[model samples]
Structure formats: C-alpha cells, structure tokens
Target: MLTPLQKTTIRATVPALQAHGDTITRTFYARLFAAHPELLNVFNPANQQTGQQARSLAASVLAYAEHIDRPGLLAPMVQRIAHKHVSLDVQPQQYRVVGQHLLDAIAEVLGEAATPDILSAWAAAYDELAALMIDTERDLYHTGTEQPGGWSGFTPLRVTRLTPESSVITSLTLERPGGEALPPYQAGQYVSVKVKVPGDDHWHIRQYSLSAAPNGQQYRIAVKREDGGVVSTHLHDRVREGDDLLVHVPAGDFTLRAGTRPLVLLSGGVGVTPLLAMLHAALTDTPQRPVTFIHAAHNRAAHAFGPEVRALAAQHPQLRTLVFYTDVQDTDQLGLPSHQAGFITAATLKPALPLDADYYFCGPTGFMATVEGILDELGVPVTRRFTETFGPSQQFILPAAALAAPI
Candidate 1:
C-alpha cells in the first residue's frame, strides 16, 4: 500500500519518466548486466542488442507511474508480464536485483531532480509493484505445478520427430525419454526451450508457441529460423531426432476464452503457431462453434500449415479460413483458390467478420497495427479485441480522439 503522498509524488514524476524512461532503462540494463553477468543467460540477447527490452521496460514504468492510483487498469498488462516471467522461471530474488539497478539508474539519470522524497516514493512504488508481480507469478507457478503430469523448472525431453512446415518453419515433436505422459496446456500457451550452442558457453532460452493441440503423448513447437538468432538457428540446424533439450512448463495468457460467441483468429508469418493450436482445440471441443481463421504470408513458399488448415476446414462445416498472399506469384492460385492476392483490409474482412464476435490476433507489428485499426474502425468493442505480440510486449496506439472516447 502507498501513502497518499507517495501516490502524488509518483504522479508528479510521470513527466520525467516519459521523457527519460528509455535512457533510464538502458542504463539500468547496463548496470544490471555489469553487476550480474549471469543474467545474460536468462534474457534474450537480440532484444537487448536492439534495445527493445529497454524500450519495453521504459513504457511499462511510465504506464505504472501514470496509473499508480488505479491499478485495476493495469491488470491485463500485469497478467501478461507475470506469465512471461513464469515461462522464464524468474525467481523472487531477481526482483531485488532489478529494483536496485532500476533505482540507481533513475538517480543517476535524474541527478538533482531525484530528491530524497522522490526517490523514497519511487522505491516504495517499485516495491509495491514487485510484490504484486511476485504474488501473481507465485500463483501461476503453483497452478502449473499442480496440473497432472506437471513438474517444476526445466525438464529434458527427447526430440522424437521433426518436420519442415515451410521454407523457414520447422516443427519438432518432443516426448519424455521414457514416453511418459506430458502435462496438458491450454491452447495458445508457449514453452521455453533452453539450449547451449555447441561452442557457446552460456545457455540461450527462447519461447515458442505450441503448434499442436495438447496431447498427453508429446508436445510440438514450431521454430522459425531467424537470420541470426542463436537459439533458433541451433534448433534449426543442429538439433535432431534423439537429441535432448531442456523445456520449461507451458505458460501464456493468450488462450481462447470460454464462450459460445463467434471466434476470429488472425495471424501472420510464424505467429500462426499458437492460433493453429487454438483452431484444433476449438474444432475438437466445440465442433458447432463458428471460427474464422485469417492468415497472411509473403507467398506460398512462406506459408505454413495451409494444407492442414484447408483439410480441417473441409472436415468442419463451421470453420472458415482466409489466406492472404501479399506477394503472390503468377503461379499462385487464388484461394489455394480461395486466398486473396493482397493484404487484409476492411473491405476484404468485412464480409467474413462477425460484428459480435470475439477477436484474437497475433502477427508482425505492422500487420497487427493494420488489423487493430480496421477493427477499431469497424466498431469492434475493445473488450472483444485480444492480441499477442512475439517479443517484448507492445501497446497499440490509437488516435487521440479514440483514446478520449469510451469504447
């Protein structure tokens, strides 16, 4: 709990946080890594190198400060972050290390402006937030461990099979060494895969969405070969059948909701992994539920699971799928015969969209932004819009007027 004075002080610091949050977060990460180099094994090197992590932290801090008194507004953000933390097996002690470096960076950056009163208030605020996160993550950890066939921390699983899904995407099927049953997970959840490249000294961990509906026998994750991604490249080029990999329990908050309302699923590039799982689960669990699955890819070569989805649609009368090939070749048949040859637009989507449906989408930033804008223009209720981003969480910005108006 924060005193009224602390809340006021936090509110007063929002402007400064907005102005220098990025620099503060960058400095915090530098100091944190310098003091605790081992943390590098836990964090994404690419996100750090690109400063995406820093920017994300900065935005989160600013939002926290701005809404210090109204924590309810940040529930969704907190839930998302807590799930990510649990996926990484983040411990409570890490909060202390992060908070220390964060405050030090703030003091270093603000200098004269970071007075005793301001620093004190900020420290309390950080403590409150940290406690909340710790509690939330504790619950998540407990829930995961309580599930049947569940275990804490990372477990070694053997890669039983591998199939190339597309030019860049390959799906690996993993099972326990002794063929023990695996824990079930909600569709759209992801597991963290930890690997050490043959010559690398430190382990690298990356989260990949489970591409298949949960079965007690095995878990499947689709890896997209990234240009210079350490873990991804290793998974693509070095990992093979009979190899063992450390995998964490599945964790994510992007699962399908419990409702009979029409469900809309949209994806782009490799973002289709989780949604594909959702599609399978929805069809299996509720065959009568109407589902619209929309996906976009550069071309057929880049598209994954097209045949599988098409086959499923053929079998299920309630399932509708739309594919968009942005760079269609002359050889590219529209549609698989039904596919459109351009991007997803309002005009293209209006016919298939259900105005009263629940919308869930995952994709590249630009594609998601376009979809969000279209959904907003179509008068989709904000409560019905759910999205998942691949890397560091991103907040979609709406027009000023939209922000001011009630949903």
Candidate 2:
C-alpha cells in the first residue's frame, strides 16, 4: 500500500508521463536491452522496431499512474499482461531489472522535473505495481504447471508438417519432440514461437494464434510472411518440416465466452486464425450451434482456409460462411464463401447476422474499428461482443468497469 503523500506525489507526475510517455518508454527499452541483451530472446525486435512495444508499455505506465490509488481498477489489464509474461516465463528478478531501467529512463527523460520526492514516490509506485505483477504472474505460472500436460518454460517442438495455406500464410503443425501429447489450449489462445533469425545472434520471439481446434496430439499455428519481418521470414522461408522450434505455453484471455445465442465470428486478413479455432470448437462440440464466419481478405490469393471452412459449413447445417474481397481478382467469384466485394458494413451484415448474437471479432485495427463501429451503432451489449487483436494486447472494447485506459 502506498502512503497518502506518496500517492499524491505519484499522481502529480501523471501529466509528465502522459506527455512524454513515448520518450520514457523508448529510452527504457533501449537502456534495458543494452544492459541485458539476453532479454532479446523474449521480446520481438519487430515490435520494438515499429515502436509498438514501447507505446504499449507507455500506455501501461500512464494508466498505472492514473490509477495509483485504485489498483483494483487495473486488474483486467494487469491480468492480460500477466498472462503474457507468464507465457514468456518472466521471472520476478526480471522485474527489478525493468524497474531500474524504467526509473533511470524517467529520470533521464524528465531531468530536473523528477525531484527527489517525485522519484521516491515513483519508486514506491513502481515497486507496488511490480510486486502485484510478479505475484500475479507467479500464480499464473503455478496454474499453467498444474494443468494436465502443462510444463514450465519453453517446450521443444518439432515441426510435423508445413503447408502453404495461401500466398502469404503458411500453416505449421508442431508436436512434442518425443511425440508426446501437448496440452489442449483454449480456442482463442496463442503460443510464443521463438527462433534465431538469420544473421541474428539473439533469439527472437513472436506469438502466433493457434489456428486449429486442439486435438491434444499437437498444436497448429499459421504464420503470415511479413515483408522484412525477421521471425516471419525465417519461419516461412527458412524453416521446414522436421525443424525444431521452441514454443511457449498457450496463453491468452481473448476466448469464446459462454453463451447460447447466435455466435458470430468476424475476421479480417490473417486475424481469422484464432477465430477459426473458436469456430471449430463450437461446430465440433455442437453442430446445431448457429454460427457465422464473416472474413475479408485482399483477394483470392491472400484468402486462407476457404476450402476447409466451406467444407465445414457444408457438413453443418447451422454454420454460415461469408467472405469479402477488397481487391477482387479474376479468380474470385461469387459463391457461398465469397459473398461480396468491399468491406464489411452494417448494411451488409445486419440483415445476414442476428442482432442478438454473441460477436467475436479480430483483425487489423482499422477493420476492428469498422466492425466495432457497426456493432456499436447496432447497440450490441458490451457483454456480447468479444475481440482479440492479433498483435500486441492493447485496446479492447470491454465494459467500463473492466478497464479505463491502457486497454
């Protein structure tokens, strides 16, 4: 617990953090990585390069200072990041290292503005926050280890098969090295896949959503080849069947919620990966469950899992599939899967989907915004709409109480 004076002092610095959040986070990461290069193994350099990681951290720091007195208000966001840290096997000691770098960064960035009293208050605040995170992560690690077929840290997995799903996306089936059963993950979870990119001495990690229904024998993930993406390029072009990869335990909170209403799965681009798993889980367990899969891609060349999902819909009477192509090609034709050309709008979807349905959506931020904008206009209850972003876990359309900022 923070003293009243300490809390007030910390609150006073919120404006500075919000104003220079990016600079502080940028300096923090630079210094932290310089001091401990080994942490590069756990962080994605691409996110750093694009400044997404820094911005995410900045948001969290600002949010923390904003809610220093009401720590419970940050529980949902804390839980989300805690799950992520546990997946990467983040230890308590690492918090100390991060704190040192963060404090130094603040001092460097703020200079004279960081008075001794303010620094002390921030130190106390950081310690308070870090203790909560470390304890929460400790509990998460315990839960993961206690689960059946679960193991701590990274598991050595062998690529059993690799199939090109589309021009850009490739599917990889990974199983335990000794052909042991892997733990069954929730439909919408993701696993961190670590590999050494060519010419990089340090290991790089990237999380790919489990793209298939868990069979217990193996886990499947799809990698979309990002141009110049260190990990994606390595996985897509360099990695092959029979190769070994280090995989973390599946961890994510963006999952299918318990509901009996019409289930709608909306995805854009490769964001369809996790939603596919959710779709499979529902259809496999309850064929009569009314579900809709509305996906949009650039063209037929970029569209993935069309045949497989169409076949599933064919087998299940209650399953509905809708696809849209932004830049339709000659190969793209009007069909059950490809419904129209252009983006998903309320006009197109409102008539096709049930307003009472539970909506699960993921995609590029713009696409998600479009979907959510429509859902909001339709007055979908916050409880009924679930979303999972494929990139960093940042913004979410959860209830007001579930989050404030740093969502």
lDDT of 1 by residue, 13-86 (tens): 99898889889999999999899887886888888998888988887888788778767667777888899999
Number of the top TM-score candidate: 1
- Provide the lowest-lDDT 10-residue window in model 1: 394-403
Worst-scoring 10-residue span by lDDT in model 2:
393-402
Per-residue error for 225 in candidate 2, Å, reads: 0.6
lDDT of 2 at 51: 85
Q: Assess every candidate by TM-score.
A: 0.95, 0.94
Candidate 2 regions with alpha-carbon error over 4 angstroms: 286-288, 335-338, 396-398, 401-407
Clashes counted in candidate 2 amount to 1
Q: Residue-wise lDDT of candidate 2 within 1-407, one digit each (tens)?
A: 78999999988888898799999999999999899999966777667888878888988888888877667778878888998888777899999999989999999999999899988888898899999998899888887888888888887899999988899999999998887778889899999887877787887778899999998898999999997788888898888899999998899888887667899999998999999999999988766679989999998889999888989888888888888889988877766434789888888888779658899999887898899899988888777888877666554223664565453
Clashing pairs in model 1, backbone N/Cα/C closer than 3 A? 334-337, 335-338, 335-339
RMSD of each: 2.7, 2.5
Estimate candidate 2's RMSD in Å. Answer: 2.5
| Per-candidate local distance difference test | 0.89, 0.86
